[model samples]
Target: MRLTRFTDNALRCLMVLGLEPTECITVHAIAVRMNMSYEHLVKIVQRLAELGYVETVRGRHGGVRLARPAEEIRIGQLLRHTEENLTLVECFDPETNTCPIAPACALAGVLDEALTAFLDVLDRRTLADALEPRQQLVALLSRSLDPPTPSSTELAS
Candidate 1:
């Protein structure tokens, strides 16, 4: 199953934070580095803060850090939080799904199993696990921010 944009960005944010455990990363800084909209990141950060996934510190020096250790932040937990619904079919949704034969639908059961299996695999991993090769991840993220070396004409300006 495909993840939504919210989940994708949340995972990216967590990965970036995982790389710099010793530093508190400002939401603005993360948004800039990730090439994401600052306003969107602000909302995402606020949600994360409310969920106890990340801690927000207020003030000029304020920023965010993982509320718990990277090791403790499980991948499945994030997936669960980020996903609004795991239903693959209309019948999977109990409220709106009024399929006439939902009680006998093997398709729905199979889909449910698939979703659970997917989460089960992710559940075995943590944010720390996802952050392997973190130095490389940091370098990949920081590349866009690197200042280009000026040529003579450019330097004059």
Candidate 2:
């Protein structure tokens, strides 16, 4: 099953935060490091903040940091929260499943099984597990230490 770019960016943001849990990092810095758009990353970060994964602070020194420990943040849980749709096939969504053979589709069952297994594997992993040997991320973030922050007008609005 393929994850949407939105979910991918969420995971990347989580990984960045996981790598440096103590320091708050700006969304612009994360966007720069991950080669993503600042605007798009802002929307993703808003969702993450709503879900309690990342905490945002406003003002000149405002930025974001992980709300919980990386080891405590399960990958599967975050994926489920970040992903709006997890259906592997059209049959997975009852409202959209128009296949005539859906009632007896063996392929749908198999896909369901595969999806379950995929999530199960992620369930066993945590953000910390994804960031083991964090030197690379540490270096990336260190270079972003002085990136521009959103202006007060931008943050206030």
Candidate 3:
């Protein structure tokens, strides 16, 4: 079961916010740091805010921050909210399923069990768990904030 880019970006956005829990980081800054489209990140942030996962501030210093502590943000719950469709197979969605053997397909049951197990693992984890390597993540993300240096070949020209 693959997650959509929307969910992926949402996770990335949350991880960034989790890095600076007390500070309100702008969506643009997150986009730049995460190499995401600003407009796309905006949509993700808006959705997260509406879901009570993020708090948005306004004005000159306005930006976004986590609404709750990272430890409280369960990965499974977030994924369920962010993922539009959790259906792992065509049979999972009866409305659009055109499989002739869907009615008696054991594969569907197996896949369903697999999907449940996948989410179950995520359910046991939280944003804080993902951020356990805080110092390492900070170092990597901070590198993106630095201005790019000219290549050796460019310097020779």
Candidate 4:
């Protein structure tokens, strides 16, 4: 039931972007804010952009921003996109399954139902729902971190 680090980072990146919807924040800044590796965040951002979750701008003043409103970004949809493998059990993937009792395993069906129910709950929620406590999140994020710095070009502009 646990999500991968890639999905985790993607969610965190979206939350940071949601915090400043009108502005483009650099990947480096996001990495700093989220305490994530810059390199790892870059890959996440690239995938997110490819999935149309975020838009990227290039150049010295370039940064990233949400492609759509937080309310339109469903958590379940995002999870489905970010998660490379959703297979909870070996039997979930027929091609690679090595389970000897997969054909008769009732556990697979039960696990599948549980997984569906989990995603169903997330389907009902959106990024906006997660960010409902905006002020609280902002306060906590700012408590120990300095404000993200603008690029040199952005400063000149």
Alpha carbon lDDT at 44, candidate 2: 96
lDDT of 2 by residue, 24-78 (tens): 8899988888888899999999999999999998889889999999999999999
TM-score of 3: 0.97
**In model 4, what are the clashing residue pairs, if there are any?**
none
lDDT by candidate, in order shown? 0.86, 0.89, 0.95, 0.93
What would the per-residue lDDT of candidate 4 be over residues 39-97, giving only the tens digit for each residue? 99999999999999999999887899999999999999999998988999889999999
- Poorest stretch of ten by lDDT in candidate 1: 140-149
Best by lDDT: 3
Task: Sum up the clashes in candidate 1.
Answer: 0
**Which parts of model 3 are misplaced by more than 4 Å?**
none
User: How do the residues 1-157 of candidate 1 rate in per-residue lDDT, one tens digit apiece?
Assistant: 8998888889888888888876788998899888898888888888888888888888888898888889999889898898887778899778899899999879888888998998899999999998878778878888867877789998898
lDDT of 1 at 26: 93
Estimate the lDDT of model 4.
0.93
lDDT of 3: 0.95
Model 1 ranges off by over 4 Å: 148-157
In candidate 3, how many Å is residue 11 off? 0.4
lDDT of 3 by residue, 1-157 (tens): 6899999999999999999999999999999999999999999999999999999999999999999999999999999999998887788998999999998889999999999999999999999999978999999999999999999999999
Q: TM-scores of all models?
A: 0.88, 0.86, 0.97, 0.89
